[model samples]
Target chain A: MAGTDDRDVRLVAYADGELDEDAARAVEAELATSAEARRLLGIHRETASLLKAAFPESRYAGGSLPPAPAGRARPGPHLLARPWAGAVAASLLLGCIGYGAGSLWPAPIAAGPSRMLAEIAEYHALYSRETRHLVEADASEAEHIRAWLGPKVGRAIAIPDLSAAGLTFAGARLVALEGQPVAALMYTRPDGLPVAFCILSAPAAGRGMLQAEREGVGVASWGDGTHRYVVVGEAPPERLRHWVGLVQRQI
Target chain B: MADESFRQALTRLLPRLRRFGMTLTGSGTDADELVQTTCERVLGRAGQLRDDTRLDAWLYAVMRNLWTSELRRRRIRRHEGIEAAEAVAGEDGAARTEDRMTLAAVRRAMDSLPEEQRAVLMLVCVDGLSYRDVSAIMDIPIGTVMSRLSRARQDLHARLAGEADGKVTPLRPARRG
Candidate 1:
């Protein structure tokens, strides 16, 4: 153990880049003299790199983020009020006619769809295990749930039949996503794990299916420009995707 | 800080927190939960955050405390132990490709490490925290941080290279020289 500690102490300094000049020089001398020291240092470097590779930061891009309550209003759009000013200036400078400045510069991109899924996953993790206050509309009352949510959500709300996927409709609720009302449908497997479908009225941007895992909850979201749908569950990705496929065809 | 700025700042730090959490929990799901809980706690107690400049370290410490509490709760409950197979990447075919096999093996090896060592290694190696920073975040002596980090790397090497036989002896206690 003493020998192991000595080897580790030298290698840790080298691996962590924390050695002072004298300590570093001494360690370098030892490395040149001893193959075992050199091998250990090599292993330390490899392990650090491998750990970073194994768990890259990007994997947690939208991980388990709570739904932000609401953002404050942006500073007024005085610039947007004068739309033709930029276009007129550009056309005069470039000596071109009909120079549409709106098309000249691209619009800023909104939050990515992955964020929506992460928010949904956060809710899923928070509420899946609850016995009460789970939903505003219980799936046991399927007729009432559909009738209540359909018109309010600004779309025809149908609880997709997932019996083929070994899940049953548990209930439905209305929740806010990004300050907009969204329809949330809950399903449960035989083992009682709750699954949720969060539907939002979003602009038609065909951001195909986006899937992610947050805190053990799996989320898959897709949109057809008019409405976006997210399915949150504890099931495997393929299973969630399979359920989403069926829902997509029906809804 | 303003609520909006605080939220935005906290949002930007999510990836790092999640990565640190992934090391602590050794499960993506638990790590995400840890991140979520940390965010919630931070948002709930925004007024108490005296040093906005040290927000990152403060968040790390909050997450560490929450995880420690969770570990204690799980110990008292004696919950089912984590499965070794769950240490692999999530259940996505795209994520489970042959190219990720090395990562999977490394993750499995990391999962075998003691939670303390894994936490220290990630803070020092991945987050690039100094031993002093790690000591502050982990609330341990600097010497202990170094030894734990060193042991963590050694254990990782042994397990990855197939030199270890499952059991690792504890290092000597930390003391000022």
Candidate 2:
């Protein structure tokens, strides 16, 4: 029953205790005489109550809270709490101090194997559940996917065969890593969980196998000095390792 | 503030930060992530924040900025399926009790609001921030904050009332209450 008048805004402000005494008294005076104003004020209170109920902090009490980042304790620059962030910090520390002395540093400080593992896991978390946009190219286009992404990545980007590991090829997409092209092969288990094998051209430093798990996803990165691979999935460590092993042999 | 004192202050703000994140993301899981990211940003850029600045407003601004960038990234990643995912999150086992069902409906309607209105509404109604604080957090004028908050509450009231009436009218420029 309230009109689009200044009193409507004033009534809300007054109800929310947002007004000074003078304006609040003005609203209270209008409320005492105007039935429409009273009803509108009631609606404002009801709306605020509804909003509090809808997004109640008490509803979130049961959920666990992540630990305060160790950055608070560290003397240096504050760091993000994610597991991979620690890895990045370690890599940076080593880079500044000169690792391997005469030998070239064994990893790219910017996006090392651990960083790649973290990134792949995050990608799986975001896009693995998608149906329509699961991949840029479907499984039927395996040859075309290879043809499309292989040259761009400067390597033979083959979609791995994991049939023995209970995964069927879903599709592949050409993604970018550090301004270089990479290929991601998407697969789905019979139970509908997704797995991806990301292939990138890494420098001589980006070699060897590194395994890390984050946010319920198991990630493993390995490369033969020229080509690096990271496999990400929601499976247990053994299962993910088995699948990654199979894919590694195939690729 | 000293590093130890700043960290202690941030620790105390966690619950409010989580609540604000919940309002912005509309998903409990995403809210947790948003809170973590917000804390990380706050600590990482603690030097940038003035000691005299309002810490709560600064934190809310950081969370809002992060959510905006996250939306932009999601838009680039895909088009159709993101909404479906959000829908699934809203209805995920929280509707068993009737009260929870009503709350869920209210949440979905709030989720449908424009981000500006939702931000202001939550800051004022849920977090109980003053209009001046919300204006600072959202980088808008106090007049804009009031108008946005009034419009938000009006829209929410109509949407909830419409749900009870079984009409489910599409949200529009709400008429006078």
Candidate 3:
């Protein structure tokens, strides 16, 4: 069935820029020869854009959101707890690289592996100290988290229990880096020290842990062919490696 | 992570998520409810996120899951797809009369699509998600995503073209028992 009418499928792929260099060249070659192909390609592209314009975000923007749920603390203590103390403590314990909003996210980041890593490392630094609403799903809900996050992340989200490492499951949230969604599962020690494990949906070619620390925060990342996993926020690289090992052995 | 503010970021995403809800459930009320439920779910599951950003995609995933379960629970609930069309066809969107009418016609044509195809079309065409993104969100294969997207664009184009040419008359049947 597909072989009969997949010409448009290929055209759509080409239009969406999903086609590889060779496939794209072949399509362009055909487009050069066939006006019909050119027209179809144009129509496909137009229709796709028109379909988008039809559902403008402004059209759906006005509806009110439901009330905030219970148990979601309203950023209370973190506000009153001597802001400087929390700030100083966070740096002392974890020493996350990028401290401020978007200003001081360490220089060596651009020199990091990928933009996803740099951006996610920044996210870890920014939110690592968040005391309230720490996770979208609490540690208690770990059992079915894989079921909830697997399909969204394109694979099973391995929620590793780091209790033996004195790191409780702080929470997990689905965040995006550079427009692609990543699952950020956070863990914290009793002293409120944070460790984040961010998982990207895409697979990797090679396998090994790439460990680094920008200025303060530590990030150790690896891939298992299925998905790329990055362990951020742990210190000294050795402990980071240990946690990564625990995650690898478990998952 | 795209936007700096959390609440503002989520509020920014509501309309888009609501529009997607309209696509899934095909009714304004249901769309709102689904989006609201999604917000509530995200709040209840608040640990699911923090500052990494891309809340829009995550919210869409959460909303899609909520709607899918609601779809299962409701079991064959009738859909008009008009509410979605109307939601988009309102006066503010289209600048000129011809544009508005064309938009309305285009929306109706979209409304006429199979729910799955409409969804694929919306995500690809309207939301600008890649085929792989749509596949992960919809939990379908890339091949399935491509075929559905292809068929949907073809159907929509054909319907609109037929209308413009007056080759096919609009069909509205008498009420059935």
Candidate 4:
């Protein structure tokens, strides 16, 4: 067997049809005399042939073709049948709704943080109850929590002070939202009630303040220039709102 | 005048167009999307199709552009685990299971190559575009395309050969030539 070297690599390249006529011919001449070269060439050809044989047969499963901007319906059926058409349509529709609604909504100062709160509350509900795996890291390791989550989230996040709010900080945990890492701070009031504050880096393009009501949890979210925060709890809207305000001052 | 004619021609080529889109995208959903986007763009710029003879390449160029842009967008959004090709490869049933596996392996190997090499190999080997045509499509010098193709093929050969040893069963003596 010929030792695999730069020359053998080059021969492999030649077999791929990468070389020009002169280069290919030179390699071919070498192959004529070298059994190892011949073996290598055979392997290359067989691999290429196998790949070609595996190339999929194209089938146009028909449905609707895309419409022209002029709204002229093309000769085909409606584009809705095509899966990508639906995705593109959904994206366009969402973009339009977002654009239109964005104009109507006022840029509330508290809205971004409130939404983050809601996300935190939800995260709390899902994982806070777990005794063995309640959080990614325990609250005692506040420094490590910040270090681990800060760079991933692309923003500096300080866990908020909740002792004054009548809750002990149970520590912060890392979570994922829309592929971006988020920071969640869990706290338990004196009565054993758990509350959470979730913070995510604000999208670069910015987003309008979004308020959500899920189950019995009230979430208020607002974003500043650098970060978006959400506060979630079982407390009434006004109470959650107040805690968020305090958190805003501390963080 | 050309716009209407282009639309007419595209309607006829839709099936092959879809197939090419599927092959390139590796996902039926994304392939359909790429084809639709290509159609929309083609329809919008009907006047651009001055040469009817090169319509196939033109459509391919449009599809390729859209796929590249979509990939960039996904990368920027940090949206992971959204592989369109893997999704499509999983959809084919047991009848063509072996073929699908082979193609999937090839696709993985192709993806493992650098972007430049992958593009060159796809254009020349799969798309059956000539070296000259690939040069035109990629907007690179012919020599560059050749070099990339060589590098791509060498890498793919190594990967596929390695895969064959573990995955492929040896042919019986009677079948061996």
Per-candidate TM equals: 0.54, 0.57, 0.53, 0.47
- List runs of model 1 lying over 4 Å from the truth: A63-251, B27-29, B44-54, B77-98, B163-177
lDDT string for model 1 (A149-206, tens) is 8776678887888888887877888776545577888877777578888776644222
For residues A1-251, could you state the per-residue lDDT of candidate 4 as single tens digits? 23455566567567656677898899989998999889877866765675554444432333444456676423332223322222322221100111112221221111111232334445657765664565677888988988888887677767888777787778777776535566778787766457778776643212223333445565555445355566666676567667767887887
Measured over all alpha carbons after superposition, the RMSD of each candidate to the real structure, in angstroms, is 15.7, 12.3, 22.3, 15.6
| DockQ, each predicted model | 0.17, 0.25, 0.14, 0.17
lDDT of 2 by residue, A1-251 (tens): 44574677787888889899889888888888989899999999988897876665543332222344665522322212222322222221111111122211211111122343345445677779886788999999878998898888678877778999888888988765445566889998878568888876543212324444545676666545355566777866677778867986787
lDDT, each prediction: 0.60, 0.62, 0.62, 0.55
Name the top DockQ candidate.
Answer: 2
Cα error of candidate 2 at position A178, Å: 17
TM-score of chain A of each: 0.52, 0.53, 0.53, 0.49
Alpha carbon lDDT of residue B135, candidate 3? 84
Q: State the fnat of model 1.
A: 0.35
- Stretches of candidate 2 off by over 4 Å are A1-3, A58-182, A186-251, B11-15, B18-37, B44-52, B65-96, B169-177
lDDT of 3 by residue, A8-54 (tens): 88898898888889999999998999898999999998887777766
In model 3, the runs with Cα more than 4 Å from the true position are A1-4, A72-251, B1-5, B44-46, B50-53, B83-89, B167-177
Worst lDDT 10-window in candidate 4 chain B: B76-85
Error of 3 at A101 (Å): 35
- Cα lDDT of model 1 by residue, B1-177, tens digit: 777788888888887886776566543334444565577667745667786347887889888887777655444211111122233224335665764666666766665676687788777777777777788888998878877888778767877666245454232222212
Pick the winner on TM-score between candidates 2 and 4.
Answer: 2
Pairwise lDDT winner, candidates 1 and 4? 1
Reported per model, the fraction of native interface contacts reproduced equals 0.35, 0.25, 0.34, 0.20
